[model samples]
Target chain A: MFYREAGQFKSTYQTDQAIFPIVQDRWFMALVFIVAFVVIPLVADEYWHQAIIIPFLILALAAIGLNILTGYAGLVSLGTGAFMAVGAYSTYKMSTAFPDLNIIIIFLLSGVFAAMVGMVFGAPSLRIKGFYLAVATLAAQFFILWVFNKVEWFFNYSPSGTITAPPRELFGVLVTGPEASPVARYYVCLVFLVVFAFAAKNMARGRLGRSWMAIRDMDIAAEIIGIRPLQTKLSAFGISSFYCGVAGALYIFCWLGSAETEAFDILNVSFPVLFMVIIGGLGSVLGAILGAAFITLMPIFLTNAPPMIGIHLAADLQKHIEEIILGLMIITFLIVEPAGFNRLWQIAKEKIRKWPFPY
Target chain B: MSAEPTVGRKIGDVILDVANVSLSFGGVRALNGVSFDVNEGEVRAIIGPNGAGKSSMLNCINGFYKPTEGMITFKGESHHQMETYESASQGIARTFQNIALFKGMTTLDNIMTGRNLQMKKNFLWQALYFGPALKEELENREVVEKVIDFLEIESIRKTVVGRLPYGLQKRVELARALAAEPDMLLLDEPMAGMNHEEKEDMCRYILDVNDEFGTTIVLIEHDMSVVMDISDRVVVLDYGEKIADGTPDEVRANQRVVDAYLGVQHD
Candidate 1:
């Protein structure tokens, strides 16, 4: 069974202390890796990669970023879209300025820029908490988007207040831009996702992550127990922004080669990512990925199903139906299992593991 | 264990000296010019009736609620003016009157958070999750595990603290504070909701912590028997004033303390 950890003995403290101690989970992860790296590339088309996989991966990263701040640190941020814009715009500028730089370097560098912006926005958390902090982050969201719209240098003097991704190569192979192959982009994204996921898992098991959790659970108690609230909150903001920035870079460079300020509009983009986190499960990394994938694919399937089934619905009507279906699914998930799709998956796996026992 | 030390040290050797401390919330004076001295390695209990400003005194000491009018010195350094977060980094750890375990986290995670002040890894290393970050996590885990074992919570190591019983949750909160390895431990009513057995267990733990770790404890408790039993010294407050301060036996026998609890009759 996918959930079983039977017969795995940990002799050392290190093994026992791993983020995931179950042997079954390790094997399942390996299987997932194979499917993502090998089978999906061989079977899936460019349409599937662009319309589903890329958006899924990007949204998953964004959800993870928000989860770090909102779920673990208990600091809600409405300005996630602004932080993402910082990432996208910074990446665009970096790539344009240094045309010879590798795409991966640009992506990582953009995260640093986003981290700074996030820190600036997160400064008010020291003075305020909970709903007040949430409102402060909303201010950041509006302020950042305002800068993107008003400042010409941010968009590299573009008349339309939009930034365009330049063609980029890594090791003499095209990985982004129109000339880049979908498989290459998919692999690059998947690899970074894996690396970041591993790092996030480790961090959550370590001191910094524990600090965030402490602050989330009880800030006063955390202080009395020797945790500095400012440092912990700032760290959460930095890391969460870094993740969002990288995802923003991925969104512009890998999926939508050209984007305007409206690309990061809070209602259209940021709220959807927030919904993904809520629908997946707030504090779990795997839940972020699962929620992203489900949200990404569900809309595509709904839009395309009528045509496949030989029922030709009008395009506008089809779009409306998709939204209605998505809304219903979100409400149903929230009402039935607020922990999201990840919890459902976990329960299903547990049930399978305990088959015939009614556990 | 060594024999109990003599209580003959002068007030001049005081590790914590509060001078003219007063905290007013609007029209009410929570603590009005309250003054006291706590010596090093002494278990000092602050006792008072309801609304006697006992908690306000502790809050001021830890830098939670800044006093409007006085100075508090710890080891000859001003601490009253310091921020609450800074107080923790400066070798102070405390438990709240309310049990404050991170509800969603396991007991181990809650305690590990206490070691946050001591962790030296930066954001870069933390994000990378290798090298110094990994080493720090391992080291911190070792210390946290020691605390867990010390508290005899090995079986419930993975249990989320909120799901635990009240006594165990209180113990977990203490474990979290103790994980800091502080020079001083501040406990706000550690035995408030405990049953007789739980209270006994907690008293043993408190005494053992002081004896084994050499941690100076300052606790606020209403139970006079507990204050007399475990504390080396007791300080009583009434109407935001320091009524008495001495050895537990001395404080117990003080006529003022009796009058505060039983009230005075004027013929």
Candidate 2:
């Protein structure tokens, strides 16, 4: 009665390797794209675009970046914020220096710059593992943000030490800076999100993805079996950082319009993205999106609950409640399902396949 | 016993020459002046008592542990030093005494990973695995599936290796190493911890691999009967030094081999 692949036959490797292997899955994805592009853009209010949809897409991309490193490669990294800082700053420099290049081009170039930085920080992973690697990446998170804060040239020598993404256009419509409409910015984020998300999915399913998984399962066995640890680990960092870098650029240009170093703070960016990967499911693209949605939506419920119940708490107290609630929710979710929502999703699918029958 | 003799070059002159290879860890010496050579297509066995450095010698050949002294020449090319990945690329493959399969991955993925050295899709093509990359992937998958069938593990092909029983995991590990289609296969106690039935099955597979594929094999085994029945040549080690080297029957009669390996108390 539910989803089934009984009659589906794979005639070629390409067909077998399709991202949406099932007909139902293909339909589901088409529906999602239609809702995101056609329906939401036309129907959603500015609050929905600015406060929910735009931030959701940007964070989902970031979460995917972290998921690639920790979830797929089995290398726990805390340098996500640092890599994002690299991207945002790189974009700032590229846009200001050229003043004529397209915003999309600048976003991509910034990712390359961040990927290089990610590789440098990822070098220590060859010798150290697990918690030690996490500490090393945490060091990168702090160090890069520190550099961004201190370097005057990065902010164009502005007194405020904040970089405002200058006005940029796409096909004669301003899509960046404060002048861009919420719809225009959302479209920009949407297009890049689709491209990067598709690229990440394909990359994770192929040889390079297998290489990362091999390294994740057992480093020594991977080495003995001919997988180069140096290359595999570095490639994971590069691609992951590339995604984070682009998202950072998008966050500054398409969402925030202007950002300070604190916007890339470790507490704000690194831990949140890590949580998104954990709650969503590591090593899963769908989980990354699901996780971003969960993290973004939960705060609304947490903060508004007290108000609805006729308790007006101070802003700081409200923030504490959100933190406590998030912490508890994460802990509970992990204890219940260490593999996270992806595993839950899988279990649900299996259940539906055997509906009205004993599992 | 059912194994047909190897189809290709049955056996040829020495293919690998290990000369005076000695290994040490900190103050302790694992091997001292160990020397041996295996001819092509021969099932060469290295038998030893515990701590006799049988595993260490295999490690040295695969370049996992650098010899503190001595040399190893494979296919007549002397190796000064080499990395583990380089040794694999050179067609020297091995299974661990302790199973080293990728536990989180499926039997299929684990076997597919064996084709890593052979698959030539670049990162960009692999990132878009729809054109040439897909073709290459399917071709290699077909080869790996054949190995899976030969090992009689088709039923467990999709199972994650971590959940499998020990004997099955060992077989899967061997299948993975074989999927590489290497010239030489090194096995560290391939039959260790197996019951008699499993041992017999593994022994048959090894013989068939050597026979049908003409692959040069050097294996470390503790089971005396298993070693004597299969190996064309036997090299006995005692405390990291070669004590006897000959045909299995000759080594069985040697006083030194019996004293060191068999541990017979002489009057």
- Specify the highest-DockQ model's number: 2
lDDT of 1 by residue, A67-178 (tens): 8888778888887888889999999999999998888998999999999999989999989988899899889888898998998998888777779888898877788877
RMSD each, Å: 3.1, 2.2
True-structure Cα RMSD, model 1:
3.1
Pairs of residues at least 3 apart in sequence or in different chains that clash in candidate 1 = none
Residue A278 in candidate 1, Cα distance off native in Å: 1.3
Query: So what's the TM-score on candidate 1?
Result: 0.94
Model 1 CA deviation exceeding 4 Å by range: A1-3, A158-161, A307-311, A349-355, B1-13, B262-267
TM-score of each: 0.94, 0.95
* lDDT by residue (tens digit), candidate 2, B1-267: 532344464888889999999998998899999999999998999998999999999999988899999999999989957887888788888999999988878898898888899888876787666679878888998898789989999999878899999999999999989998988999999999999999999998998898778899999999888888888889998888899999887888889988877877322
| lDDT tens digits by residue: candidate 1, B1-267 | 122553442223578888999999998999988888887777889998988998898889889899999999987788557777878776788888888789989998888888888888876687677777878877888898999999898999988888899989999989989998987889999999888889888888988888778788899997667777778788889999889888876776778987995254221
lDDT of 1 at A137: 89
Worst 10 residues of 2 chain A by lDDT: A10-19
Candidate 2 off by > 4 Å: A305-316, B2-9, B264-267
